[model samples]
Target chain A: MKNFTQFQWLKYTVTNIPDGFDDMYWKKSGSLKISFIILIMFFFGIIAKDRLYGFQFSADYERTFNIIPYIMKSIILFVAWTVGNWSVCTLLDGEGTIKNIFIYSAYAICPYVIQIYINLIFSYILVRDEYIFMQLIEITGTVWSVILMFSAVKAVHQYTLKKTFTAIILTLIMMLIMFIILILFMLLIQQILIFISEIFTEIIYRLRA
Target chain B: MKKFLIMFLCVIIFAFPLNVNATYNYDYMRNAIPSQAGYNVKNVLYFGMNEPQDIFFSGENFYIADTGNNRILVLDYNLENIIKIYDKFIFPNGKETQLNNPEGIYVSGEKIYIADTGNSRVIISDFNSEIIMEIEKPVSEIYDQNKTFIPEKILVDKSGNIYVISGNITTGCMMFSSDGDFTGFFGANRSGRTAENIRNYFVSDKKKSRRKRNIPTGINNFDISEDFIYTCTENSEKTSDIIKKLNSAGKNIFSDRNLHFGDYQSEYSNSGYKPPKISDIDISENGNINFIDSETGHIFQYDKNCKLLFIMGNISGQSGGFEKPSAIETAGKNIYILDSGKNNITVFSETEFGEKVHNAVDLYNSGYYAETLNLWLEILKYDGNYTYAYNGLAYAFLRNGEYKNSMKYAKLAGDSELYNKAFQEYRRIFLKENSGKILIIIFVISGIILIKKRGEKF
Candidate 1:
């Protein structure tokens, strides 16, 4: 495991699953660089899924296209998931740190991220009648990634299956709470900026008068 | 001095803007795109009419139901002179009664059908103002007994079947026989399955009173063409079946087609979002559907396939614009819309672009796809962003066995079904033409693979 390169580790993580996560957890063999690259690929994969999919399957409204929402969806969700899982596991007396949770989470979704490109390519070749094959590919990839996610949590935290499930549910709740707080904070900042601008405008108007 | 002269000229040019016609059509993305005027306002007739509710053209005359004046005015086809007026009718009992705010009129041959809305009855009369028959509230067990019958619009089929659109009849058009016998409702609107309706379905009768009952909106207007009756509902709350083409069996054939009849997007105004309210519908001579939206005061014209052809007119204080477009009728090449608020008729004549589109659509609908190729191409020259033209060209190419061009136009039109069809044909033809070359390549690859295997064994 120590001798393996970042690509080799990713291959092992995809194939061996729990064993690879166990090595990363106990021996610190996981590469943060590979995890970061995977996250970037996942972001681009989401965009490609939306814009580059076949016209029949894609529901993108080209006239009202905007990139900000996609960026926010990918980056914010990734950050929140990492932080929420780390905090929840720590509270539950689990052993995983923030870095381990981030790496494992990224690695766990490798199958789904890779499946996006495959689905995009197949969408152009397959007609409407042959869409069941595409649907099967999508379902298999999603299910495999979900199973890998469960194993990753179990191995990173060194916990039983039941404890791992509780940690995951708590992590989802934590993510929701963080999202709400983040929205409220953004709204508060907006109000403060508006108030400051209004005051500055009033001062300028008075001086001109 | 030269610079000053140029500046003055620029200012003068900027001050007087070009007289651009306010005509637009929705693009493939449902965004409004400015296009050439399909129909130009030829004239606006104001013959002292007041609140004309409906208009119909038959033979060489225009029948206008002037509701405010409580009379029917018949004008010539040119709309230049009054042909006749039916204000009073002699009843069978030797009694003469004036029309009480008649809202609708249908002239079939020499017979005149008037929906006397204020009198709560439909009066069938001859051209000489002699009352032939009167149809009152339908007496049926299915019809609600407590509701009052107020006939708003009426039409007579070729077989003498009378269909009346009443104010309170939510079931559908009130069907009447030639002898004034109430048969049954026709083409009733489907009640929406809203959340409240779903909840009420599961709740007990006693507890269901807490929620409001969802009643389907009644049909506002209808026109008969051949054996089909096209109906329009003015209610904005329910837009799924705003315009329906009902067969003789009273079933909407356009239901499963997923056609959005009116504007796809709502416009925000001072009163919030306002969806299109289609007040009237008329089928043209070429079988094109022409419907008027009262909210935006625009007339939307669509081909037989429910593809939008052109959008004309709007809300303005001009001769062409409408205040309240209550009725629409197409005669020959002219479309006449009656505006109730303005109390006049605005006649619109088709332009060159419109003629080309109509010809292409007519030919395509008649299965003469190859003939429409030149017309559709000409229409594209007029408006390059016309998706219907692209679709028409795709079909034309497909019929002409030009699969590659069909695929190109179908992709431009965003018609994936047609694109797939063209692609399938292209692939089959390619494989057939290259069969010999393909076989030779396959043999060569197989021989190479076998040679490599033998060498590895050795």
Candidate 2:
């Protein structure tokens, strides 16, 4: 084979490699997996929102739980963020599929496991006294999280240090493209729905009159 | 093949839970709905071509974290959309023109900081979105020294230090120098690093399941104050979201898991009841917190002590109240709530009573001593029963060195309980000066005695 140019080499390294992104070879499956993860995240978000605001949904506790719209907003935000992250990983990490990105986005949960429990037992007890300790824990979590993310990115991209860097840049561009496409699609869908709803309402009103 | 298997196993072992002695209980806080009418929408300010994830307001302009559109939507004071596009920097090949997913947006001093989440880097640009500088690659061990970690939100302090949230949701907020140096990091789970058990909780599969399968509990959103950082956590125990106060170094000064809404218990067994979620939180310049509930469209306000002060907005139809409110902010006497579902912004003016109470606070925040005094005086004219107005007037007089006036209003602000702290400070100065008055009284008495004695001698 002819020697690859820097451009060609970079592309080969980021997307064409198989070690890191072998599973994503099945693009459709990868995308499905990501969708499922997103669903789980959404459910968890709801649970968190309900718990945070102390919403029991009881007629007795209706006032506390009526904050569903706020919870929904959080869920939507979480979905958007996770999707963005997955889209980037899939396109650039040599996986080039939504499925792999979805699988890896679960990696975020790794750090939360520690954060939640520590918060449960220690956050309140430590109070002002253990604030410094809490800060350290946070720093450590970030460091560990970085390590985990690096491994995940490396596994999916299967590239050298230089190649992985290139994948990151490419993935960003891909995410941008995907984001724009999704937005356009959503806008189109919204406009069409609005138009149809208006026409249907007009017909109903006219018939009644 | 055996060697490869061994390496894979080692990787798994390496990533295993590092902390294990931690106990987690999600049943402590009960989840339940507090009311039927729920929260009312304040206002919704809608813009951008697609889903707006994060938004920043500075001066007369608003910047959208238009995650869906993969670009930042610029808006003017009238909420009109502005165009900001850039096409520079050739990637891997000859590909150029247009940026990738610009997720998080931060504008400061003519420079815009973008998380550019897709690129796994932070990009700094001019107001026009032109690429100025970038932290594309991890140069140091500051953030995932060895692997590629995604960068989320970005913040630039008054001192110009750049702070980026990287890693995942469970980790604490990370920091970096303006020049792209990995200065330090803070705010993970409580318990020091010596407690390996604490670290284990962060990496446990069961814990992950609870977070993924259950509810999220960790630092998700944060805002910086002059001396402290206010942050919110997505808690699993169905109470209220946690509000954390951190020092300048990212150390937790105090954390209130249930910040605003009082002790609420939710009956989660029945699927009918959906608990309220705190979608986005905001802190006004004066340190008042406005947290929006996505489900009910209610905006809850809390003081620095995490006490519930007021719940603005009532459930209603259409854009008047809220369909699905996302974010909140305050400008002057108006509160703006962004209703994403209705794609409209609902605006609410402060209550007459709330406005009167805030005038004093506003003057205090803006450092207008005379003006603050005048405003408080004006408020007192309308309603003389306002204790806070008196207290505020006392503070104004104190700031202006009107001690007597300060004492008068200070007592009204509940001098013993409310202004007691400030009164003590004033007392210190009053005592030192009291000696001068005592000397004058003594001199006058002696002079009177001398005049009487001279008349007796005559």
Winning candidate number (TM-score): 1
Expressed as tens digits, the lDDT of each residue in B410-450 for candidate 2 is 65444433234344455567668797997899999999999
Q: Tell me the spans in candidate 1 whose CA falls farther than 4 Å from its real position.
A: A24-27, A191-209, B1-21, B143-146, B191-193, B198-212, B266-274, B429-458
TM-score of each: 0.89, 0.45
Clashing pairs in 1: none
Model 1 chain B poorest ten-residue lDDT run: B265-274
lDDT of 2 by residue, A7-46 (tens): 3322332333333233333232233443455455545544
What lDDT is reached at residue A84 by model 2? 60
Worst ten in a row by lDDT for model 2 chain B: B19-28
